[model samples]
Target: MKGTASACGSATVINAIATGEGGAFAIDLRVKSTVSLTGDPSEISGKVGNTEEDPELIEICVEKVLERRGVRDQYGAQIETNTELPIAVGLSSSSAAANATVLATYAALGGEIEPRDAIEIGIESAFNAGTTVTGAFDDAAASYLGGGVVTDNESREILKKIDIDPEWRVLIYLPPGRSYTTEVDVERIEFLGDLVEVARESALEGNVFGAQTVNGLIYSSVLGYDSQPALDALSAGAESSGLTGTGPAIVAVSKEKNVEKIINVWNSKEGRVLKTRPSREGARIENG
Candidate 1:
């Protein structure tokens, strides 16, 4: 049996480590996963097309899905993932991959599961694989459901779903290296809980741009990243700008009129820049 699925990536509005509550918006970057089950129950493998492969995450996703369906010992699977989203850049690549893989595995098994259940399975797999800190429910929800989401990561509950202006553009500035979530100092981030809560409240109140800027600034300072790129983007007329995930990748949200100006400024920086729009569509199984 074989199945295929796709999920978009998301940018952070509020990192959850500080407050256990977080917000994120879906972006156009995507990850696709294909699963093929083999008769040999002992042979399981996974490969990533663009970046370094995390076989443990992929394996756990398949295993979790199979176990959920009570068919873990029935078959082994081969998983292949291809992504436009960059890994370890705080773009929700791991969440997207896990979601797509879980969905694909379910499709291959000819079964259906609640969307929330599927997302939880992916979250569990991520935590087990050490790819996440607070389970990243906000990122997973945004990537799975699309648009924007405010979530209680610890409780794995989505507090709200938001719609972003579709006309706005998202600009990402990827620096030279990647920062892994597992490597982050959780205690230091949590020290900013009081401030992050203020940003989280702003997001809940629909002031996403302001919240994103503030949250990004907080994480950037605590994570030891340069905040000038975000400041530069804001100076270039971006609607909002700040660090997206943990570090190293800055995101700038802007109107079409300000996009070119922001891009021009970001181009002068050290790393490359990518332009995309907020995704309103959720993860789905693709027809073969």
Candidate 2:
């Protein structure tokens, strides 16, 4: 049996580490995963393309799906994933990968799983792989459901899913390095819980860009990342700009008129710039 699926990546409007409540919006960047059952029932293998291989995350996703279906002892699988989203740069790459892998694995088993179940399975896989803190429910929901989502990560509940304006462009500044969520300083972020709450409230009130700016400022300060890129994006007419996940990458939201201006400002920096738009489409099976 074989299956293929794809899921979009997302940028943080509010990183949930500080407050259990967080927000995110989907982007056009995507991860695709293909799964094929093998004759060997005890061996599962995985490969990732366009970045470093993370066999552990892939295997965890596949194994979890097999176990959920009570077929873990009956089938092994070979999983392959490719992505335009950069890993460890806080673009929801892990969540997207897990979603695609889980969906693909289910399809390979000649069935489909609910999106919520797939997201939970992906969260479990992420925790097992030590790829996230707080299970990243906000990121997972945004990636799997598309558009913008405000979630209570602690409760694994989506409080809101906003259909974002598609005309807005998302500009990402990718620096040379990467920051993993597992390495974040939880204490430092939690110390400013009151501040993060304000950002979360702003997101709930439909001021997503404003919330993103607030979140970016707070996290960047606590995480010791240079906030200059985000600041420059704002100066260049971006409606919202901030550090997305942890560090080393900054995201700016703006209209088409300001996209070039923001890109020019980001291009002057040390890293490269990627341009994409908000997506209302979520994860889906590509082929059965």
Candidate 3:
């Protein structure tokens, strides 16, 4: 596969911000992209597929975007993703993949697609490809910019950028089970939308610790998942604790000194634990 464009990765809070909207926060993590177009157009596949509201649709969506750009098909392009982020566990996997694919495709073509434009386009692709519920521009932007961001998706505005104090570590708790954001019934959560807005305001006011913790509780109550794990994190002296995106994965924010205690408490239960820090950069393009 021939033309190439690539971008970095970020995380968003999703539907937790914006008036009459939801909450989202983007975190910077590891991300890179590579694109190739050859005479051979190979079928791409991964653990992510159309089954169970598969978040892997982000890859397919990128391919479709490439096709729409008319740079592929005639020349053809292939995208491969390698990341530590898990799918359907509310970790912004789709947003990261979309950011990488679009930026790599642009790089391969040697054209100019501003980072902001690239992020907006990637969000649109996720919507068109049926992988997202509300276009998820907040998540897309965080995935694009790599620092903490609060965005209003409906108005297409960024309300704030929070420079996470590097002293903090983001510890994520992943249960063996998976939950898809696309599969969630928005109408059922609509009643809780007001609570989501409250969380959003706290996030914009530089209360991310409070925002994430409260957002996690609100979504947990609505989604019918256990909030005990997150509570446990907070109980262990974490600076902040809450759900990551929708369900199943609980995030705890803490200083380096508290890492072992947090991990010990998390692993004491039945779950997978990941220790990570905020990524300061977004996406990039590379060569074979």
Residue 280, candidate 2: Cα error in Å is 0.3
State TM-scores per candidate: 0.98, 0.98, 0.86
What's the best-to-worst order under lDDT? 1, 2, 3
Deviation from truth (RMSD, Å), model 1 = 1.0
- Residue-by-residue lDDT tens digits, candidate 3, 1-288: 434333333333435422334444445454444556556455443333233444344455456555757755655555555556776687777787778777766666666567787777787777777777767767777777767777777776777877776567888888889876778877887777667787788787778788878888887788888899989888888988877766678888888888899899989888788877776566666564
lDDT of 3: 0.68
lDDT of 1: 0.91
Q: How many clashing residue pairs, candidate 3?
A: 38
User: Residue-wise lDDT of candidate 2 within 151-251, one digit each (tens)?
Assistant: 99999999988888988899999989988889887988898999999999989998889999999999989998899999999999999999998867899
Question: Which regions of candidate 1 are displaced past 4 Å?
Answer: none
**Model 1 TM-score, all chains together:** 0.98
Better of 1 and 3 by lDDT: 1
Worst 10 residues of 3 by lDDT: 3-12
> Superposing all C-alpha atoms, what RMSD in Å does each candidate have to the true structure?
1.0, 1.1, 3.3
lDDT per residue as tens, model 1, 2-111: 99999989999999999899999999989999999998888788998755666789889999888878888889999999999988898999999999999999999998
lDDT values for all models? 0.91, 0.91, 0.68
For model 3 the local lDDT of residue 24 reads: 48
